[model samples]
Structures are given as C-alpha cells and as structure tokens.
Target: MKKKIVFYVRNLEFHAISKNLQTIVNSLDKKNFEITIIVGEKKYSDFILDNFSKEIKIKFILNDFLTSFRSKKYKKNFKNKIFLDFIKLFLNLKSIYEIKKNNFDTFIDYQGMYLSDFLKYTSIKNKITVLHENRYIGITNDKKRKKIKKKFKNYNKIIFLAKEQTNDFKLLYPDLKDRFFNIYNCFDINKIKELSMEKFTFDEIKWVDNKNYGLMLSRLENGKDFQTVLNALGELKKIDKLNFNFYFLGEGSLKSFLEKEIKNLNLEDNVFLLGNKTNPYKWIKKSNFVIMTSHSEGLNNVIIESLILEKIVIANKFKYGAEEILQNKYGFLFNNENYLELVNILKKITKENKKSTDYFPEIKKSYSRFSSINILEEFNKIL
Candidate 1:
C-alpha cells in the first residue's frame, strides 16, 4: 500500500510556498506515495488547480470564516495576533477530526504551527512539522515562547530549511536537536527550463535594444534592500561612462517609496520597475547580470533560477543563501557597504574573465527535483 502524504497550506494563492508544493507533488513517485494538498479558499484557486497532475490528488477546503475579516478594522495593534489565534484554534480542531477520520500514514504540517497539536490530541503517532523559520526570533514575551515550546514538543520530526536555522533552534531548545533535520530547499531544473521557454514581452517599457543590463526579481520589500541596488546604479552611472540598464520585477508595499527614491536619484532613464511579472525567466535570460541585495533569505528561489539560466549573479554577503549558492564560483559576492564598494566590484567584474557559465550543469544537478524527493524520503524515514 502506498503511503499518504498530505500538505496543509493556509492560503491557496499563487505564492512561492504553493509553487514549491506543486513542484514537490509533481516530482514524487505515484506508485510509492499518494500526494494531496489541503488549502483555504482564494480568488486564484485556478492558479493551483491548473498545475495539478492527474496522478496527484488535490483537496480544497473553502474555510474563510476566520480569515474573511480584515484585521485593519479591528483598531487594535494586535489585530493580526487575535486573527491568527482564531485560525490556530480552527485548524487544530479541523486537523484533529480529519486525522481521526482518514488515519493517514503520515501527516506533514508544511506551515508548522499548532496543527501539530491535532496529532497530539488525536494520538496520531505518525506526524512531522517543518518550521520555516525561528518563531522566537521576532516574538517577545515568555507566554508566546511557552506556547511555541508546547507545539514544538508535539512533532515526531522537525525539519529546518537551512543548517544555520537548525542550529538556532537547537540553541534555543537543546532537547529538540535530535528531532531537527536540515533539508535545503530544492529546485526543479526541468520546470525552470519549462518556465524559461515561456515568452515575455516588455515592449511597453521601451527597453534599450542590445544594451547590457542587470535584473533583480524580488518583492519590493525593505528587507530586500533594493535601495542598495539603486545606490549602486547611481555610483556606476557617476563613475563608469557606459550605458547600462536595470530591470526590476515584482511588487510590494515599498513600491511608492522606491519610485520616489528613483526619481530623487535621477535614475528614471536607467532603472525600470517593470512591476510584477508572472514569468521572470525571460528577463533573467536576457540580462547580463542578476543581482540580489537581500539582508537575509532562506534559500532564495531567484538565485537558483538565475544560476539555472546561466546568468552571472552579484549578491550581498548576507548570512543567508547568497553566499551559500555563490561560493563555488557560480557568481560574485560583495560586502554590504556604501555605493563605492559595489561600484568597485562592478568595475572588477567587467574587467575579469566572465566565463562562469561552466558551473551551470553541476549546480543544476545538485539542486534538481530529484534532490528534493530524496530529502522527503529521508524525512519519511523518521516517521
């Protein structure tokens, strides 16, 4: 009999988590396992439904009662806190009932919250929860810590996305180290290649014809540090007498702020915020260089995508995925300093041998979909 593997996701929108889940389900062997997804209702349900394969089973739970109300109207600063508590309660009860009804071989909590409490309450022995990040890092107060500690003890196995992330958890709770597993996020080489084939047109932006350009594909968030890229560009423009452009893809809360900054820097002619594009691979392929300025990340999908597309990447020396991926001469890394450092690095890269595409095949093999499946198999071993 095949083992049943169910992924529980809170939102059904076409976000990164949903996309990653789809890739995992598609890669799993149908003969060995039965894959299913349970998600909340969303306007873009079809975004996920269209990607489903015939071999995989998908279940949608249209539960929006808890999430239906906007937290902004509550007027309390802790509105989100109140709303999430309600969600946690509902999910805990729902998961407990479901586990009792189906008795799945293994219940995997992808979101990794109090859903694990369901297994504890129902006495479902086979259960695993993957923690995406350290919850206590941003949370204060001993009460929240105690609550998380209670939830942490319920999981049969706890999977961490990175080694550093695992170590952080171990440092916090030494006893849970035995249950921690570090599984780096995997990339789908074939799927990335498939996405690359899709054509994207930016004739609306009137991009310069046959000009060297760099691309940054990320949400316009403060943590991403896009201002660094703008400053770098301003320095490059001031010193180097070359005509180059930057194509920024994606949208977020900082869009207006970034727009004002660009105008202030007089970069309206060189930098183009192309907004959010569904397919960013086309821009990646066309660009001469890919840049990432994130203050932190958890195995960024864009870096892997850029590597697969054979575009040279320049990223900040952050504690996260940038240095991890670019260590083997696949790309370049610079310190997080003023624009002078970035300008100097850009000058150096322009002068040095730019034949770094030789490492593409190795990178593709190491982070392939097969690697993810192997990790999942190891995760199942604990159960």
Candidate 2:
C-alpha cells in the first residue's frame, strides 16, 4: 500500500522551503508514495508550478488572513476590521475542513510556523515539522518561545537542518529531545552542474584572468551582516593590496544602504551588486571562490552550490551548518567577528588556490551526499 503524504506550507515564495518541497515531491517514489501539496496562500510564482511534480497533486488555497489584509475594498470600508475577521473565521473553518478530509498518513510542515491550531480542531495525527532557519532569529518573544516549547509534544518528529541546530534545541527542551531528527537540506547537484555550464547573457565583469574573484550569493539583509565584507575590503586596502573583486547576487531591503557603504569604502569598482538572478550557477562557475559572513543560517545553500562547482568556500562558524558542511575538508571557516581573519584567509587562498583541478573529486563527493534521492530516502525511513 502506498503511504499518502501531504507537504503543507504557508506560502509558495521562491525561497528555500518551496524549493526543497518541490525537489522532494518531484523526486519521491511514485510507486510507494502518493503525494499532495496544499499551499495556504492563494497565488505563487509560475516558477513554483513549473518545478513541482506535474504527475502528483497540488492546490493553492486562498489564505484568508493574507487576502483579507490585502483587500482594497476591505480597507476602504469602515467596517473592514469586522469584515476581515468574519472572512478569517470562515476561511479558517473551511481550511480546517479541507485538511480533515485528506486521509494522509503523514503531514509535513515544510515551513516551521504555527499550524497546530488547525491540528487541534481535527483528528489528524502524525504531524511532522521541519525547522529551516536559524531559530534564534524572529523567535525572541519569550511567551511565543514558551508556547512553541509547550507545543513540541504534539509533533511526531521535529527535523532540524543541522547537527548544531538539533543539539541547541535539545539543550533548550531536553524533554522533547527524543522527538528531534537532523536532516540536510537537499541540493539538486546534477541540475546545478548542468545549469553552471549554460552560457551567460549578462555583461562580462572586468577582471584579470589570473586574480581570484570571490562570489557572495546571498540576500543583502541586516541579519546577514554584509557590512563585514565592505569593512573587510576597506581594511584590506589599508595594509595589503586585495586581489579579489566580490559579486553579490541577491537583493533585499538593505541594497541601497550597502551601495552607499561600498561607495564610502571606495569599493564601488571592486564590489558589484548584480541584484537577483534566477540562474546563478553560471556566475558560480566563473568565480574563483565563495564566501558567507552571515550571523546565522540553517544550512547555507550557496556554500553547497560552490563546493559542487569545485570552488573553495570560505565561511564562519556562524550559528549552525558551517562547520558541518565544510568539516575542515572542503572549505574554510574563520571567526565570525573577525573580518580581518576573513581577509587574511582570502589573501592566503588567492596565492595558494592556483589550480582547482585537484579539489573537484572530493568537493563533488560532498554534493552527492545531499542529492535529492538521499533526501527522499531519509524521509521514507520515517514515513
């Protein structure tokens, strides 16, 4: 008998959770597993629909909270507050009914948010929730943390993205430690390799063929601490001549501020903000190495992508995933607070990393370990 599994998510944005879900559903064993994805948000990018398993089932429900809040008519009406509340009440009841109708053997919360409230109103058991980010951020409310801590008993298994994330959570809630499991975020290693070979349409970045250029594929957000890169570039100029030009590939609210800082540091020519790229693999392939200076992460995908492409990855211990992914074998990690250490390391590697041919085999092995097949197999063990 095929086990019915449903992956539940709040929204289908072009983020890690949606991508991981699509990869899992697209690659699941169709013979052994019957799959469905129920999205709470009404609309998602066609990119999502294109990537999801066409052979399986997918539904996008009108998330009333988001709909009601965004409705212009509701905002114009003086009674909008009460009207929105009524809409929310109707939608919640309807959504709960839809959820109860599905007789799934397992329900996976692809995004770690509050959905247990719906579970309380239904008889469905075997709820599994996966945490995909550094839980330390956006979880500072002591009351909310206590609520989540109390609710941990309701889940069958809580999956963490890294060993360190799991260990930290275990330390906090020793009682629920037995319910926790660790899983690496799956990377479509082969897909990335193929994409990296595609030719680039963007203008060529000016650089010497011999000097190593570092790629930073991340969102320009405060949590990421991108200022460290700028500060490091400024500091490198004072003492030693820096050889690398860094390219940032993602966008965020901090873009303008970062541009200003880069100008102030006189690094405008050295650092280029390429904004967001739907396909960054070609850029990844051309770069000499990759670097991440985030304060925390669940599992940095860029680091894995860099390794798969046979480029050296420089990162900090951050909070989680760094040490586990790098393991002192494939990449380098420096003090998160010490930008100087990052510069020194980058400088040293620029001098030493003349030939990457020797690192390709071992680096490729690291990527194969996190491929989609392994991810589905791990899920099958629990399902």
Candidate 3:
C-alpha cells in the first residue's frame, strides 16, 4: 500500500518553503506515496497550489465562515482579543480533528512553526517538521528557546536544509541530537530546464543583452542585506568597476527603502528593481552572475538554481547557507562583514567576463545529488 503523507503550512505565500513543498509534493513517486497538503489560511496569491499534480490532495483548515473572522475590517469592528483567541483555539482544534480524520501515515509540518503544536495531540507514527529559516534568528530569549525545545519533543524527526544547520541545532540542543536530520531541499531540475527555455520577455532584456548584468532572485527585504549590496555597488562605482547592471526579482516591504538607497548611492543607472515574476529561471539564464547577500538562510533556493543553470554566483559566506552549498567549488563566497570583498569579486567577474560554463562539468556532478530519485530516497529513510 502507498504511504499517505500530509504536509501542513500556515499559508502558501511566495517563498522558498512553499515553493519547495510544492516541488517535493509534485516530484514524489506517485506509485509509492499519496500526498496531501493542508493549509491553515487562504490568501489571494496561493499560486504555489496550482503547480501541484492532480493526484495531490489539497485543503484549507479555515473555511469561508472561519476566514471571515480573519479580516482587518472584522477585527477593527469587533476589537475583541478574546474573540480572536477563541477563533484561533477553534481552528487549532478543528485542524487536529481534520488531520486525525484523514488517517495519514506521516505528517510533515512544512513551516515548522505553528503546525508543530499538532504533534502533541496527534498520534501519527511519523511526525516531521522542516525548518526553512535560520532558527537562531529572533529566539535569543532563554524562555523562548526552552519553549521551542519542549515543543519539539514529540516530533519524530526535525529536518534542516543544510548539514551545518543540523550540526548547529545539535550543538544548541544536545538532548535532541538524535532527532535532527538533514535533507537538502528538492528541485525539479528537468522542469527548471524546460522553463528556462520558455520565451518570457522583459523590456530590459535588450538593454542587458550585451551588458554583464547580475541577478538577485530574492525578496527585497532587510534580512536579504540589500544595504550591503548597495554599499558594494557604491564602492565599485568609486573604483570605476561599476560596468554592469544588477536586478532584483522579488518584492517585499523594502522596495521603497531600496529605491531610496539606490538613489542615495548614485546607483540609479546600475540598479533595477524588477518586481516578482512567475518564472525567474529565464532571468537567471540571461544573467552573467547570481548574487546572494542574506544575513542568514537555511538553504538559499536561488543559489542552487544558479548553480543548476551554470551561472557564476557570489554570495555572503554564511556558516550554513552559501558556504555549505557553494564550498567555493561551484561558486564564490565573500566575507559578509566586508563589502569591499564583494566589490572585488564583482570587479573580478566583470574583468574576467566568464560565465559559470567554466565549471559546468563539475557543477553537473555536484548538482546530481539533488535529483528527485535521491531526494525521494532521503525522504524514505526519514519516513
């Protein structure tokens, strides 16, 4: 009999976790596993759901009636915190009821935040939670750390995207060492290849055709360290090495700040903030380099995609993110503290004008581990 697996997410926003969950669910072997997704809330752009295969089941815990209570207008009109708490309580209970009713063989909490609570109540033999971000962030308080450790006690396995992330977690919580597992995120390599060939047109394509443009495929947010990127660009300008354009492909609350900073740094001509796109692989295919300057990440999806497309990548040397993926073998890593290092790397790339094709042979071998078959084997081991 096929094993029944269900994944829980608070919502399906346009981010790596949701996208990875969609890819993994779709890529799983249908003959061996039956997949279902349960979302806690509904949103206007749940586009991630549309990518799933027809065989995958999908549901929303908050039906229309429960969803109405979540509106800003409703909250403003009622102004009752108790009512909101009651709603959350009801939803949690309802979530437990619905999940237990499904009789799934395994429950995978994709976000690893709110859904982990269900592990205490559910008796599912296989309980797993996947942490998508650097868990060290925003949990400095001892009480909060203790609470997280306690909450994670009932989980069968706690999945981290990088081996270093797993190692760090074990160091932080030694008692939970046995529960930690590292499953590198999955990707649909074939699908990305096909999508990269799609004739998606952007107006600036011609302007950047002959220019050495770099692509940053991430949300324009503070944590992504756009400030550092802008600073590096400013340094490059001072040294007369700013010969290329850099484009950001995702949208976030930092768009206005980034625009202001770009003008402040006099990089208006060298920077473009293209809003999020349905398909970013085409952009990656067109760029000379892919850059990542995040303060921290579990495992950056763009870094992997850039390597898969064989584009030169320059990323911050985070202990668990870029360094783990690139290892300075497939891509370059610079000191996160020194913007000048990034500037120097950018200058080197512009002077060399080399594509990642220089290392395409090795990149292919390095990236083969992310194939669906290999990832499925990892999942089977955990399950």
Which candidate has the highest TM-score of all? 3
lDDT of every predicted structure (CA atoms): 0.69, 0.76, 0.81
True lDDT of residue 151, candidate 3: 74
TM-score of 3: 0.92
lDDT of 3 by residue, 1-383 (tens): 99999888877778888888888888788899988888887652546767779999888888766676665444443556778777788777777787898899998888875766666677798888888887554577999998888878868799998988888889889988999999999888888888887775667567456777888888877678787888989988987947788998999889999899899999898898989878888888888898888888888899998887888988988756788788778888888868888888888788987767574447766577776668878988876
- CA deviation > 4 Å runs, candidate 1: 41-47, 63-92, 134-145, 202-209, 350-355, 358-383
Ordered from best to worst TM-score, the candidate numbers read 3, 2, 1
Which model, 2 or 3, shows the larger TM-score? 3
Ranking by lDDT: 3, 2, 1
Model 2, poorest ten-residue lDDT window? 202-211
In model 2, the clashing pairs are none
Clashing pairs in 3: none
Cα lDDT of model 1 by residue, 1-383, tens digit: 98877777776565566666676677777888887766643334465668777887665453445545522246555866777667667655765676567667777787656475566566556677766544455566789877877887887688777677678778877877887787766657666777877654667335635677778888787678787888888877777753677888888889899889889888888888888666677777777788888776656777778887777788887656676667656677788756567777677666563644543435544345335656566655664
Q: Give the lDDT of residue 68 in candidate 2.
A: 43
Candidate 2 per-residue lDDT over residues 1-383, each given as its tens digit? 99888778867766666777777787788898898887766656567677776677877667555654644453455587777677666655666666678878787877874565666776667788888886543587889888887667667798998888898888877888989899888877788899898866635544424546778888777768687777888888667776678888888889899889889988876788878777778888888888888888888888888888888788887887888888877777888878888888777777776545454346656777788877767877777
Total clashing pairs in model 3 = 0
